[model samples]
Target chain A: MKIQLALDRLTIEQAVAVTRPVSPYIDWIEVGTSLIKEFGMDSVRALRNAYPDHVIVADMKTFDNAVYEFEMCFSAGADIATVMGAAPLVTIEACMNTAAKAGKKVMIDLLHTSEEQLEALQMYSDAIFCLHVSKDQQEMQGSTQGTEGFYVPPSLSGEGRKLAFAGGITVDMAQALTRIYPHVMIIGSAITKAKDPAAAAKTFYQLKKE
Target chain B: MKIQLALDRLTIEQAVAVTRPVSPYIDWIEVGTSLIKEFGMDSVRALRNAYPDHVIVADMKTFDNAVYEFEMCFSAGADIATVMGAAPLVTIEACMNTAAKAGKKVMIDLLHTSEEQLEALQMYSDAIFCLHVSKDQQEMQGSTQGTEGFYVPPSLSGEGRKLAFAGGITVDMAQALTRIYPHVMIIGSAITKAKDPAAAAKTFYQLKKE
Candidate 1:
């Protein structure tokens, strides 16, 4: 599993400073929803400029006007951008098409998506499906234990599936998560909010290899 | 019924200029999701600064981390902010609480939300419930005609239930919609994209008073 570092609730400068040390340990960088809301596309451009080789994911959490959003995101240098699975299928399709045309990727966020909704998304096999826990739910539950409750739809998992898992992931959870081996393990507060983000990232990186 | 002008896909300057004349006729100014995505909270701050007395809405379309999103939006000088009804009940509840604390308002966006989900939201009666047709859906249908198929959940509508309707509202539709009389009728491109925005707003304003 590739480790993706999610930077949120931080200014562009702070995000860059935090990620500089952790960059070597993490595989992908996420310009999180908070950062995007606080700083706009400049946040994505800032990370892309700083880490030339790193894959940048703009957590747009887009629910409508997918084509416009995905177009703007990819144009702003996002290698991958996310749209909510809760969005209409046409919107998801728009994101997929926009990504494909731009040679970028779209991560479909499955936050609060029903099983029936999940069934309709199977045809978008090229896209990455994210099993996400809301940040509020994580805070309420204390840790990233919400990932344990993730139900992988049988139709979505068997073969050639690109799945990502995100919340407040920690080094301890990394060990167990490695077994299931999602395509990407998105770590946010556990690393970004850490007193020692580089060390936290290193620990998760080392655990991913184990 | 109040008229809301949705400023989208425009720079902060363009948004201000477009809304300046239309402001007299509109009750609320929505710093639309597109403007927010492109310009961040600065867009809300800009509109609020420009029109001190106007009700400025930050269309945050928050789906996760409601407290953080709503707090940021409200702090940025928005009189109202939107959270997706498609969001988990806990997240929506968090938004309601946050908005309550701020003495602001929350508009729950019912985009791609199921009837069963709508049933769960009746308790948040204090919040303004928006019956939104996605921008993508409206575009696909060639106009704002998607609002015609809107199904207002009986449980959600009645006396004292504040409901808003959005998505490409036109002058012709305004005549038809006035009978059902949603609390706020949001017009976007219909005014902002018009060659004569001032005239469009005046026309709608006249229609509303009729």
Candidate 2:
């Protein structure tokens, strides 16, 4: 299991500063949607410059104009750009085509996507399907309630598609997912908000290895 | 009817320069999603500083973490911010609450939203329900094919809720929407991409007035 550090609600400077120490342990550095909204693609460019070897994921949560958004992010140095699973299939296809042409990857965020939507998205075998639990849902229902376990859709089982899971991920949760083996395990506040983000990341890193 | 000039696919400098001449005729100055992704909330601040009298909208297209996203945009000087209608009810409520507290407004972009979702959102009467056609849909089906007419959900009528329509809006399209009288008519490439953008904006402005 690979650890993806989600840098959210931070300024560009803070994002760079926090990730500097943890870069080596983490597989992917995610420029979260809020940070991207706060600082733009420059944040992605800045992170890319700071950590040249790390895969930079621009968590754009893109819903429309996929071609333009994907091209912009990939040009700015994003290794993987995300499109909302709730977006139309054509939009998703546009993003996939752009990513394919650019020699990059797309992570489809299944935040509010319906089961039918998920079924339709299974066609994009090359794309990474993210099983995301929305932050608001966590806040409303209490984080401990919903995100503790991995949910592999019945249709996705043994389909050979890359999968990632996100939302309120903790050290214990990370250890649990290791057994099921998602391609990426995205953790946000648990790492970014820790007293020592680097040490916290190192712990998750070692846990993933174990 | 009001004309909202959408600024997308431009650098911050270009967005400012293009709107300088057309600002007088536009009611709302929208910092589009692509511009927001490319330039961040600073784009909203820049337009706010440049056009103090105009209502500056940060089209954040917020999908989750509504409170944080809405607060960030409102603080950055956005008079209005958008929440995706496809977002969860709790998320939409969070955005509406934050907008209400800040004395700002929320425009719910009903892009890819289902009728059931629309029915649930009708409770937020003060929020502007934008009947938006996804940009990719326009490209796939031709601009004139999908957005030529306005759509208001039967449940939304007579509810005293504000209505807005967006996607491929031309001067002629704007004139047609004005007859039905949506609270806002959002125009993007029609004005921003025109050879003489200011002249194009003036035509829409005059059409709204007539």
Candidate 3:
């Protein structure tokens, strides 16, 4: 499993300084929704310049204007961009097509998507499906310990289909979650807020090996 | 009913210059979602600076981190900010409470919202409920001509509750849409992409009075 460090609520300079220490342990970097809204595509550009080798995920949480948003993210040097699964089916397809054209990737965020919506999305096998619990939901309902109600949709369970899990993940939950075999584990405050962020990320990275 | 000029896909300077001609016809100035994402809070601040007296609606289309997003919009000098109706109830409430505390307003974008979600949101009587069909949807399904299948829930039909209708609004539709009596009519490409945007806006504004 790969570890993605989510950068949010911080300025570009702070994000750059903070990530440098933990760079070796993280395989991907997520330029979170708030960070994008707060700083625009410049934030993405800054991170791309800072970490030239790491995969950057622009967490746009895009609900509409999928084609434009995905194009902007890719132009800003993001390797992958996210669109909400709750968006219109055409919107999701727009992202997929745009990503395919650019040789990039799209992650579908199933934040509030219904079962019916999930069923419709199963055909886009190449898109990464993120089983995300909202930050607000996490605050209200507490941590999910990575796999409380984990159920992979059959179509998405095929080989080469990528699955990502997010929302209040802790280092302690890393080992058990690996059993479910997620392609990416998105960790935010657990590492970003840690006093020893590099060590925290290293610990999670090491756990994946165990 | 009021006319809102939706400014999108333009630089901040271009947005300012474009609205100057139609300022009298438009009651509200919307810094659209793509504009906000492309330019960040600076877009809102620029419009606010240029049109100090005009009601500026920053269409954040906020789906999560509700409090932070609302706070950012309001602080950037937007008189009204939008949140997605499809967001969690707690997220909607956060927007409401933040708006209430700041003496500002929140518009709930009911784009692709489920009936159950709409039912739950009826309690926010003061919030402006926008019946929006996205640009992608309009392209895929054709123009709705203002009110093709308009249905107002009993709860939202109460006095003083504001409703805003958008999506492919044309000058011809204005006369018919006035009968439905939406609080605000959000017109985008119909005006922004018109040969004479000011004349187009004036035509819609004139129809409202007739």
Model 1 misplaced regions, further than 4 Å:
A141-143, A146-150, B142-150
lDDT of 3 by residue, B16-118 (tens): 9999989999899999888887778889999999999899999999888888898988999999999999888888988999899999999999988888888
Q: Candidate 2's residue-wise lDDT over A1-210, tens digit each?
A: 778999988889999998888888899999999988998989999999999999999999999999999999999999999999998788999999999999999999988888888888888899999988889988976643133457788767765779998989888888888888789989888888989988899989998767
Steric clash pairs (candidate 1)? none
Clashes of 3: 0
Clashes of each: 0, 0, 0
Error of 3 at B135 (Å): 0.7
lDDT of 3 at B73: 86
Docking class of 1: medium
Better of 1 and 2 by TM-score: 1
Ranking by TM-score: 1, 3, 2
In the order shown, the candidates' Cα RMSDs to the true structure are 1.6, 1.7, 1.6
| iRMSD in angstroms, per model | 1.1, 0.9, 1.2
Give the per-residue lDDT digits (tens) of candidate 2, residues B1-210: 778988888988999999998988899999999989998888999999999999998999999999999999999999999999988788999999999999999999988888888889888888998888778988975644133556667877864678888888877777778777888988888988999988999998888667
The TM-score of the first chain in every model comes to: 0.95, 0.95, 0.95
What DockQ does candidate 2 score?
0.78
**For model 1, what is the alpha-carbon lDDT of residue B155?**
80
